[model samples]
Target: MINDLPIRKIIHVDMDAFYASVAQMDNPDLKGKPIAVGGGGTRGVVSAASYEARKFGVKSAMSGRLAIKLCPELIFVKTDFERYTEISKRIRNIFFDYTELVEPLSLDEAYLDVTENKLGFPSASLIAEEIRQRIFREVGLTASAGISINKFIAKVACDYNKPNGQHTVNPEDVLQFLADLDIRKFYGVGKVTAEKMYLKGIFTGKDLKAKSLDYLEDHFGKSGSYYYHVVRGIHNSEVRPNRIRKSLAAERTFNENLSSEIFMLEKLEHIAEEVSKRLHKNNVSGKTITLKIKYSDFTLQTRSKTLAYFVRDKAIILETAKDLLYQNTLNNSVRLLGISMSNLNTKPQKTEPLKENTVSVQLQFKF
Candidate 1:
């Protein structure tokens, strides 16, 4: 039985269309319109889309050109991370007042452990509402929250209601809440993994739980064990206050596919600078420099070089990235280039961008 597990009150707070909403908040003219934040030029990729834009099938990671095709009146605004960060800090302050056990997943989302909070409130649902209301009053933005017995459930619940809403799953209802969930809705199950589940006759959490642990392990390896337990309402992961940074990265998607290494040097140098600055900002350095290349045909390749000592200098990062880049032969026309440093010297924080993971048509790396 999962009775031994502690029933912690967890809340996942996610700002609705954070980047786009922030844009609309600052500029009244953009409110209630089909506005997109970032992805402005012909080759730009959308970073965020307003609900109006979403209704038109416009979405983040979509090509701006295609987003315009979907919503003819879609407006694209530049991404101002500095402004977003400033506003995010204000939101974090509100979270801190409730509980110091706040784990920021990103600029727009976080997990708060309110099982025992500073306010000593017993109802997480009410606290979530109050937090949402505070965000609106102070930051002029709406936030949706999901409160549950654990982080995974809370994360999934937070997305149940879209903009300006909240959902709660009591401890007793956790099993039913998990059972009724679609296989794809499982937090860690991506598109490929979901497809794998469907092929294996696993269509829902109930179907997933029907299989024996041995059966799952035989098919999905360690992840099989993970799925087996989480479906049974048994995620024991705690809300870690100090989430260590795994890697720091900076990347750029070109308007046109570049085939020459000579043409890539300037771009790589710029990306290295961005990655180095972030490492310094965190007061950490890493020894492993990985160069990520995305081909025009959508295949991915990574080359890594580890040094004897940690380094965070732009020149060092640039040189190392260059070494790894030139180490391999150019396979095809390169559409994107990224620099990432891992094996960090210090235990850093959570939420550094993994820019190389996306292959957007116009996902430019602009601050």
Candidate 2:
């Protein structure tokens, strides 16, 4: 079955400790020091932790308080998104020099289809190596690259060699490589899913392959079919370079929580303006308007309304968000307010360069 699949050169490049690495590169004093990009306040969360800090169990999304407790000597630096965005653009420019078939996963990671590259490089391994070296030389940061036949394997392989390294999984070795991998390491297999797989005596790709498709579906529902084929190295999902923006969103976390509906409405308008600008900038609009509210206690609630026609007007987005805001009772003070537009009605303009300011909220399924 695997032999029937078309072989393609896919590379997943992920920057190492992206935010913290950038901070260290810019400031020579931060090199080799345990640093985190985010506030060290009680309520703040660590956005990224340097490799030095990770040795002490510090990680991204962990609360600053906990991060400090884990590593008292950890240094916290505020996030500099503008700096990161500038660097990301430079790295992307390097990627485009090789292949236009580039799918950016985030500010620091992307999947590049170098099967037919501009440089006419025959070996994806060489391309991946060149990319990493160029990123280090031009961008002053390290990146890990994983080269395989498909996105799933490439993404997983990219992590095999962390920090500044690259790994390649040949077509013939895909099965053995996956079979030797722990089930917990499979894409989309979270902690809970791994535990369930363990309870079912499936701990590795080899173990998962032993179960029948029907059995996996019975055990895991819709996702079982996904797991069934991916375990067998049968993923056929293409690396979509021109993936459409399913949604456009802008969110802001306030310095102070607001209990008043008037203040909340005011903030919603500002957020709506930001979202509107992003929509217009992307030349896309959507029918569904969602309002996300994160209370002072960090509990989140979302309200959405789909209109009959897609609209990109700021007034319409603000009005819809306002209506949703009023419909929900203010159960608690709000700390963050966000507005998003979905059910898009426009396609991306291929000629336009990808904007650094836009945020894609949709999840890209590998298979």
Q: Give the top-scoring candidate (TM-score).
A: 1
Tell me the TM-score of model 1.
0.92
Off by over 4 Å in 1: 1-5, 347-367
My TM-score estimates for the predictions, one after another, are 0.92, 0.90
Cα shift from native, residue 358, model 2 (Å): 37
Which regions in candidate 2 have their CA more than 4 angstroms from the true location? 1-5, 347-367
Q: Which residue pairs collide in model 1, if any?
A: none
Q: For model 2, what is the C-alpha lDDT against the true structure?
A: 0.88
Count residue pairs with overlapping backbones in model 1.
Answer: 0
The digit string of per-residue lDDT tens for model 2 on 144-258 reads 9999878889999988989799888886677889999999889999999999999999999999989999999999999999898887776666667778889999998787889
Q: How accurate locally, in lDDT, is each candidate? A: 0.88, 0.88
